[model samples]
Target: MPGMGFGIRIEGLSKRYGEGDTAVDALKDVNMTVAPGEVVGLIGPSGSGKSTLLKCLGAVIEPTAGKMTVGDEVIFDNGWKITDLRALRRDRIGFVFQAPYLIPFLDVTDNVALLPMLAGRSNGDSRKRAKELLEALDVGHRAQAQPSQLSGGEQQRVAIARALANQPPVILADEPTAPLDSERALAVVRILNDMARQFQTAIIVVTHDEKIIPTFKRIYHIRDGKTYEEAGQALH
Candidate 1:
């Protein structure tokens, strides 16, 4: 499906919390598209529906109304199209959070290999995939290290490797650079861009970090439950 040039396609996406007069419309008729190998930015002020939109896209919360196509699969249309959301999330979507959140008990290789292993891949193959991703991300040297043994940047790189282990067509990065300094933050964004192109996966980074905003070639700004698409810098 990824080879067919599918990415993430959303149309009329909306989310409402509660009902009646007290209902809060978190997202209002939002439409956005990201192509394979593209790295796009999603930015907004605090409480501007960014988190709500992310949750919907990530399948963490059900949207009141919307249509969503991930890769070539129509996961949501007014309601869910797929029955196993847990499998869908685990297999089709990858996530990178503000913190690395690597398993403390696992080594770097096992940390990444865990995702593929959970997907039913053989242990040998999973670790092989993990090593490939780690090498691509330049964290191969720390493959045997524990999570706590790595630096902040190294740990985040491992997290990213883990996210890619399943070879998902889409990656949702939620403030991935929030914990880093200016230099490290920009470096992480660069890695995301390179990896997106390398693996032909679409990436949407939701962040408020000023240091990484200008790095995006395209940006979507959310405000008042609505979205406004804005062009950012040209591809670097």
Candidate 2:
């Protein structure tokens, strides 16, 4: 990976599935850019290729064409510049889904530490990093608690800590507030914004929740495989 700033940029990105006659164009000339410490919303209806775009950004799937740059490094242009997709994802991209998705057998500390551990860090160092993140997220009190013992909000906080463990430049969050009430949902967005600024991380949130939509400073609305950028009201 080349040394670069903290952000992600995508230009003319497109994804296609199947053969010519049976082909489906999932994304068409999609363009997006997120700056470090900024939180943007990615809103789209069902079957609008939101997931496809996420997968491409996450390096879970290869795009058929376009350019993707993480910070100043060109990760994908026509084809991936780096050979190890798994390592690329693990090292550069963080992800938060609708559910907490914590490991059932591990406690909160170990759950967040698992990412660093998988990346070859020593157990002690990984746990140390996890503890710091848990403290930052205000979940340090539950560091020893099992996922089963945690409240929904606590579990989600731990999940956010895990995503920030590596201090990745970009985090892709998909409907992270879906399971929470209005208050908790707004709380999640607040946390995301705070974390982004604190860590200088760029975050793109994919959501359909109307309650938090107005909270974004900028939003990308995807429909029929294209994206339109809009300025948001950005609730404080």
Candidate 3:
């Protein structure tokens, strides 16, 4: 019901960390298409430009050259086609970081509601939407609980709920299950799959965790700023 067929599209994405002789080419000619409701893994060793690509795709940093499209909008073309990149990020993109990073003072519900509220939705409406997402993630029972009261898995679930609060077209996850055990790691992947299917969102998880690495049906391996795609072994 929320923005179906909302996949992420990237073409010729290249990033440079500096300029002139000191510049480092973080990403080189990175091109990828993530279909709606599809989940893929981006795996690489440290310093392979994974972070750079994520920054570019998430609009946290501009790419030196590339085109980026989210859902029905073209966000970047050579330079950004849209003004207000921050607003675009808030409205069109969702991010799940390695850590849950929920606020200590705010309860789970408030944390999730914060996104919609920031985007001009009413506080009540935002909280309502947040509650719905919490229920969907099976964390509604802990809505009133503070971050400190929840387990690691529960907090991660809340983080995921927060990410989906806006129902963004694309969700970028950076080591989403890094802090969990094998059981919890697999659970997070399953949750990601369910969320992608339910919301028809494109998800890219950047991770080095071996536990969940094999679960991905498609994997992108990056080395020295270049990428090669591989079809993973069957999950069944």
* Candidate 1 segments exceeding 4 Å error: 1-4
Candidate order by lDDT, decreasing, is 2, 1, 3
What are the per-residue Cα lDDT tens digits for candidate 3 across 1-236? 12344498788889988889999999999988788888899999999999989998888888999888888788999999998988887878888989999989999999999999999999999999999999998999999999999999999999988888888988999999999999998898999989988988899999999988888888899899988899886363
Per-residue lDDT, model 2, residue 183, is 93
Instruction: Give the TM-score ranking, best first.
Output: 1, 2, 3
lDDT (CA) per prediction: 0.91, 0.92, 0.89
Report the C-alpha lDDT of model 2 over 1-236, residue by residue, as the tens digit. Answer: 11236499999999999987999999999999999889999999999999999999999899999999997799999999989888878878999989999999999999999989989999999999999999999999999999999988888889999989888889999999999999989999999999998998899999999999999999999998899999998896
State the lDDT at 168 in candidate 2.
89
Error of 1 at 118 (Å): 0.5
Structural similarity to truth (TM-score) of each candidate: 0.97, 0.97, 0.95
Candidate 3 ranges with C-alpha deviation above 4 Å: 1-6, 234-236
Clashing pairs in 1: none
Better of 1 and 3 by TM-score: 1
Candidate 1: C-alpha lDDT: 0.91
